[model samples]
Target: MSSSSSMNKYWIPHLDIHKKVITQELQFYLGPEATVRSFTRDGEDGFLITTPGACLTDEQIDDICVKSKEMWEKQAAARAAGAATRVLKRPLHQPVVISKAGASESTRRRRESRRSNETRSRRDERRRN
Candidate 1:
């Protein structure tokens, strides 16, 4: 018997089917529990995007594919931007006082005193050793 038998054959082609697609797959599955209505409206709900199996027009389907791709690209770029901004080169907290002094007489005196004290401590340690 031919596959297009009267008993099982459909008079209208698959292209005739049209359905409104407003909700996303996440929203669809996240709705009520599985039922016969769910199967008739949306295809199998076994962890898949509900938009694919819907009987939308060819143009609508094509537009959906293009828009979905664009959206995915935008989302990827946003994620990369977020990650880049999140990373920091410097430490978490900044010091309250930077303590940078110009080459004044007091600064010169302090540097000389620090060096003399350091050398004296090192000489004493070396002599003891």
Candidate 2:
């Protein structure tokens, strides 16, 4: 077997969900030395935990498995706790639709009022003069 292939068989790293791989966010969080071997969707919504691999002796691999499991369990617990916590949700406003509907109601009222007041004032000044 090729050296790389052999290395993969013993120390290959990958992560997949059923078949597709996970995002870079999960990979970086796993640390540089960890290689994501595969991932399985955790629930109906497709939450996932990626499996990782590393090059190690048999003993080291065993220790790593234990440590990795601990880390994952802690992370999962933290996630569950966070999810249970209440958070304020902000409303998103969609874009307003504009049309050639002339001026807005307020603007039109203001302009009409201003013009009427000016006309009345001009008439009163003429009468006084």
**What lDDT score goes with residue 107 in model 1?**
88
Per-residue lDDT for 1-129 in model 2, tens only? 223433332222331222122333334444443344442333323333323344344554344455556666777999999889846474355455673355676787898999999999999999999
lDDT of each: 0.45, 0.49
Query: What TM-score, computed on C-alpha atoms, does each candidate reach?
Result: 0.31, 0.31
Best prediction by lDDT: 2
**Model 1, range 30-60, lDDT digits (tens) per residue?**
2332111122224422221222222334564
lDDT of 2 at 30: 48
Give residue 56's error in model 1 in angstroms: 0.5
Mark the 10 consecutive residues where model 1 has the least summed lDDT: 7-16
